[model samples]
Target: MHLLEVRGLGIRNPETGTEWILKDVGFEVGEGEFVTIMGPSGSGKTTLLHLCAGLESPSEGSVFLAGKDLAAMKDRDRTLLRRKWIGFVFQFFHLLPDLTVRENLELPLRLQGEDPAVHEGRIEEILDALELGDLRDRQPHGLSGGEMQRASIARALAGRPPLVLADEPTGNLASRAGEETMRLFREVHRRFGTSILLVTHNPRDAAFGDRVLFLFDGRLDPAHALEGPDLDAASVFARLEELGI
Candidate 1:
């Protein structure tokens, strides 16, 4: 079974058009798989991510995480499921400015009712693995763009959840930092076998994934999907050019 399945997803609302325009999107991410959804800005990528995370209700179709329909679950149950099963990395590096890096990593565990005493050591392991050990006490405002992103990654991996959804994780970084971030993501998946579904418009970034799916104007054309054991940036860009994405 797929770890994450999005079938025929669409947005709905009589007044707002964000829901009115997107329709019939579908895809799946297998366990231990790394997949990239490549689309230009305003392609409904964020909306799709939100739906998959159960942060929004779909107007049509459904989103399934590990065989459970997110929209079918009660609000509290869905919240608990998300807290325990999904890790999120966003473009903005949503770390709390007031909290230290270590504290930010611990927040998700605490929210899930995990005892800090037990998870603290695990968080340390994550910090060390992600090379954030010395910077763990620094607040978000004190860190560089790269450092903040590293800490965000550390926090996302704190619980070692099975599935991670990253939206333009390297979007705000410089070329060198962005490369480092992508390599870090690849290493994390290699070492931990975490299923990752990342969305980005950059071909270089999208090429890091085992498979690449193209999204244009909020729609996925399965015919344009690229699959390979070693897909490269050149090929990804070629596909994008052909599709005019």
Candidate 2:
């Protein structure tokens, strides 16, 4: 089964009535594949992510995750499914202020009624992988922007969810840090067979994915989806320029 699928998905801004933010967006990500969606600012990239996560209802069409239809499920069931199946990394690094880095990383496991003690080996592995060992005892407020983002990604992966949804995860970091963050995503995918769906405007960020999709003006442009040598960052940016996107 596909890890995630979107069929003719459309989302309209409730406040705006007739205007559609995303229209007829459709795609699928199979198990262990890394897929990216790139778009300009305000191009509905985050909105599409929200729809995939079942955090918002689409005005039309459907989203299915692991063969379960999101629009057909009750809100509580959707919440449970999300807890069990989806790990999300946000651009803003939504760490809890009162929780220590260790605590923050353990929060998802705790929510799922899993004991952190049993996951110590895995947690240590993540800390080492993300190079976050030094920041374990610190609070979110004490870390640099890149450090916080790394912690956020670690937290998302700690649960070993089948699919990870990242919305501009590196958008807040410096170029080097952002590149490092993308490397971590690739590493996790390679080591654990995790499926990742990342959305960002940055071409460098999009290049890391197995498949690259470009979204603009509320539509996913097929002409811009890239693979092979054409999937590099330079190629993606060049396509964007060629398309006047």
C-alpha lDDT of all candidate models, in order: 0.88, 0.92
C-alpha RMSD by candidate, in order = 1.5, 1.1
Please list all clashing residue pairs in model 1, or write none if there are none.
none
Per-candidate TM-score against the hidden true structure: 0.95, 0.97
lDDT of 2 by residue, 177-203 (tens): 899889999998998788999999999
Off by over 4 Å in 2: none
The sequence of per-residue lDDT tens digits that candidate 1 reaches over residues 81-108 is: 8877799999999999999999999888
For model 1, the superposed segments whose C-alpha errors exceed 4 Å read: 13-19
Model 2 has an lDDT value of 0.92
Cα deviation of 61 in candidate 1 (Å)? 0.5
- lDDT of model 1, residue 45: 85
